[model samples]
Target: MRVAGLVLAAGGGRRYGRPKALVRHGGSLLVERASRTLIDGGCDPVVVVLGAAADPVRAVADLRGCLVVDNADWVTGMGSSLRVGLGALLATDSVAAVVLLVDMPGVTAEAVRRVAAGAGPAVLAAAGYPPGRRGHPVLLGRDHWAGVRATARGDTGAAAYLRAHRARLRIVTCGDVADDRDLDVPADQRGGRRG
Candidate 1:
């Protein structure tokens, strides 16, 4: 199946005091790192949703080979970004999508590839951290796009939808090979060697 990459980079970074997409890590912007991780993990035609400081992110982030999408309703929350990204992926010939967050600089391509390798048009997969915690780089099959979009609201993203379909969800244990830390606050930004 053809699985595309969907990077949600529209957050305003209200908590972080700056657009997280533009945040630098390992000599590259966070958005660039996220997109590159997806591409390296085997996703084709990566689609990135941009909103907060879209112009500046475009200017700094090397978005070459990516399908950049503008989410006008990004201020509303992550749900809008998710909807916009999934919609863009739906327009393609992709059978599923590997969803990554721009703020999660710790998630590596290995994690993305592990989840994406098991994704299909009707499959649902997510990266699992230690102690059975679920995190980003979610694999949403095309079959669940409409339902996920319908339930996606506020900053919840696809949490509700994924919970509703928990019986069929697959959890890929990635904690052993990847970190799922998110750069949400200033303290997270202070860490060394991100990404």
Candidate 2:
């Protein structure tokens, strides 16, 4: 549906001691895998937001041709990065945007596709994972862009936007997968499967 794919990879990853987006998962870096999922799910004009380790992360992922936005104010918080990323998308031709987190390596292509396909002016595609936990690659329509950009502050994310507009949210279920499985800590980067 001509949606924009935003990869939120600007975090410092202080808990993991390095950039989590470039962390190896299966055979590819997490950011690359996430981008591939978005591209496969029908998103065009994808953009990746970089911060903490922007240079090495970009080099490791080989994102030479892809659009990249630097979130120099990343230290401010996730919301700052979100605003930066969204601002970049504003210059593009995307009618809808599915914002993905670089740490979520488990977010399947099907999950992304389902969300992107259901985007609308007010309806947001919320991730329905186990225990009813909603998470990112949340699809935000162009209508919500202004409000989203205005309200983002500190660590607060689009969740505030969803809460303020609960009636407009369209929950898209994606089985038992924990699309919210973010690899912030070392244990989380280990696939959350202990032997």
Candidate 3:
């Protein structure tokens, strides 16, 4: 079965000041980096959910070859973005989606590959970092989309559903290939959010 990519890039980044999707890091916008990562990771089709400064982001980000969707409720938080991203893929042939946050520039395609190694409509997996920490690049199977959408709310987003299904979650160790450190502040400025 095919495993697609879903990027939640709709946050306004109240903490980081500007929207995370527009944040430039390592010579590329966060949204561009995220979409590229998914494409490089072997995901057949990638979808980016835009919110906050959606129009401005589209004007500059290199989101070519990917499906871009808008989240009118993005100000509400990541949950709404997740719901929208999942909803967009409801008609696709992909059996699962490997979710990536736009703010996490450190997560590599290798990490995405590991998490999506054996994705399926019934499979559930997530990347695990050092010292026993389960983090992003989460692989959510099609079977649980409805439940995830129903419970997804606020900034927590898919976290609530993953926590409840911890037993079924296949933790893929990705510490060797990637880091989940997110850009919290511009150093020159103050804070930020994720995509």
Best by TM-score: 1
In order of appearance, the predictions have TM-scores of 0.96, 0.91, 0.95
Instruction: Give candidate 1's error at residue 59 in angstroms.
Output: 1.3
Task: Estimate candidate 2's alpha-carbon lDDT, on a 0 to 1 scale.
Answer: 0.80
State the lDDT at 71 in candidate 3. 99
lDDT of 2 by residue, 57-172 (tens): 87788664458889999888889888988899888878888888888877887888888885766657777865676776689998898899888888787878889997888888
lDDT winner between 2 and 3, please give it: 3
- Candidate 1, 59-142: lDDT as tens digits: 878989899999999999999999999998877999999999998888899999999986789999999987878987899999
Candidates' RMSD to native: 2.0, 2.3, 2.6
Each prediction's whole-model lDDT (CA): 0.91, 0.80, 0.91
Q: Which stretches of candidate 1 lie over 4 Å from their true place?
A: 192-195
Instruction: Count residue pairs with overlapping backbones in model 2.
Output: 0
Error of 2 at 35 (Å): 1.4
* TM-score of structure candidate 2: 0.91
